[model samples]
Structures are given as structure tokens and as C-alpha cells.
Target: MKKLLIMAALIFAAHFAYAQSENIEEIQQFIISDVRYNKADVTPIYLDAKAYISLYRVKDEETIYMANVWPAKRSQSYGYIYDLKQTSVDATDDTYKNETLTFKWSYKNDFDNKQGTATIKLGLVYKPTGIAFLMTMITEDLNVTEFKGYVSGSLNLK
Candidate 1:
């Protein structure tokens, strides 16, 4: 009887592990598009770029790190890392089914001689046809200029 119980426990554990892995993969497959940026009193910049952005959860989903790399200049790449402060998943709503992630981060760009702080609010809304994303960034002290941008994307996560 003990051996049978042990085998059952092992089977349940394996199933749980597999489910967790699948969930992680779904979170990693978010596709970013329709990127745009605007600074205070400056012209808006539209980006013709596509990239796969992923969020890594650590410490049993208590900490989440979002990291993505994409092209910036002719031969340069720009990367952004955000540590999430709050997260919520709402799948019951009929209209706005989304997972919302909020973050506040501060960094120093020595090359640009700027100490910047940013508050990012991102949401992945699930539609009947596809997944849509909305992201807003509010930044300060970037080249001594405050900036804000609203960007939208289609997430191709299954």
C-alpha cells in the first residue's frame, strides 16, 4: 500500500511540473509589434520592429523579470529589463480578459549622462481572435527630459 501511494504521489508531481512548464512557455511566447515612442514636446517615433519578449518568474512567481532585446540604431541593439512590482490575471471578464503587470524601475545611463526612472504599466488582453498588448512608459531624467509613450502589440502566445 505504501509503495502504491508513493507511485501515485510521483505521478501527480510529474503532472504538476509539466503544467508549470507549459505555463512558462506560454508566457515566453509574447510577440511585440506596433512599437511607438514619444518624448515631452518632441515628435513621436514609430518603430517597425518585431521581437519576442519573455517574462521569467522566480521564487515561486513572487519576482518577475521581463527582458527583451531589439535593434536600436544602424548596428546597435537596445535592451530593456523590468522587474515587475505587481501582477494580476483576469480571465473571467468577457470584454477585457488580460494579464496586467506593473513595474517601477530606475537606472543610470552613463554614456548618455542620464539618471532615469520609469514606471511601466503593461497588459496582455485576450481577444476572441488574437492576443493584444498595451504598454505605457513614463520616464524621468532621460537626457534631462521627461518622456511618455503608449505602444500596442499583438501577442502570439499559445
Candidate 2:
């Protein structure tokens, strides 16, 4: 009976580990189309750009990659590419309601070496046909931004 119990515990631990890894792997690359920047004593500015974002695992660590974004525009067609290291994540498994995933990251600007923390909250809107995500990111500089777009894939809320 002791051997059987040990085997069961091992299986449970393995399954839990697999689930945790799969949670980060299931996120698909999605476009962050709309960006709303809110700063102090100023009206919010909205930028309609074709920025892309993706979450993936690298060397057993999860990374957040954001491409073609603001602060990098040279002419009329491009922007800076940056990646943030995933510091923490919390996910809810219940699918009956809107599933929310909160991801936090610590990033350092490569050009200036200034360090900051950012938190991204993604809400998966439950619908019948297509899946939509609304993400809000708050940075360490107290800049609040909102990103809205439709995603082709879903996040594993576990």
C-alpha cells in the first residue's frame, strides 16, 4: 500500500509540472493593435499601430516578446523591439466566466539600462465564435496603457 501511495504521489507531481509548463506554451502570438497611453496632467493618446506580442518559454524561463512598438519609429514603418522577463503569473482555471491571466515582468532598457517593472493583465472574453483579449499594462513609471485586439489562440488558465 505504501508503494502504491508513493506512485500516486509521483504521478500527481508530474502531472502538475506538465500542466504548469503547458500553461505558458499554449499562448499564441497576437497583435496588440490599439495602444492607449495615459500620463499625468495630459489627455490619453491612442496609437493605432500594428504591434505584435508573444509569450514563450526560453531555457525553462518564460519570456514576453513585444515587437514593432512605439519609441522606435524611425520613419513611418517601424519601432523598437523589446522583450521582458516574466517574473510572476497568476491564472484562473474556471472557464464559465471571463478567464483572466495576470503576468508581471521585470525589464531593463537596453539603450539606457534603466530598469522597470510592468504588469500585464489579459482577459479572455468568453464568446460563442471568436476569442478576444483585452490587455492592460501598468509600468513602473506609472504609465498606464491599454491594448485591445483579437487573438487566434487561447491561454491555458490553470
- The candidate scoring highest on TM-score is 2
Residue 32 alpha-carbon offset, candidate 2, angstroms: 2.0
Candidate 2 lDDT over residue span 64-96, tens digit each: 443223333321211122443223233347543
Error of 1 at 47 (Å): 5.8
lDDT of 1 by residue, 1-158 (tens): 99999999999999996886565522344455444455333322323333334555544464444543333422211124466655656677456566777776444443454555667677766776566666666666433222222222442346
Off by over 4 Å in 2: 1-26, 39-49, 59-97, 110-112, 153-158
Residue 96 displacement (Å), model 1: 3.7
Find the candidate with the highest lDDT and give its number. Answer: 2
Off by over 4 Å in 1: 1-29, 39-52, 57-63, 71-94, 106-115, 142-158
What TM-score goes with each of the models? 0.45, 0.50
Model 1, backbone clash pairs (residues 3+ apart or across chains), number:
0
lDDT of every model, 2 decimals: 0.51, 0.54
Model 1 quality (TM-score): 0.45
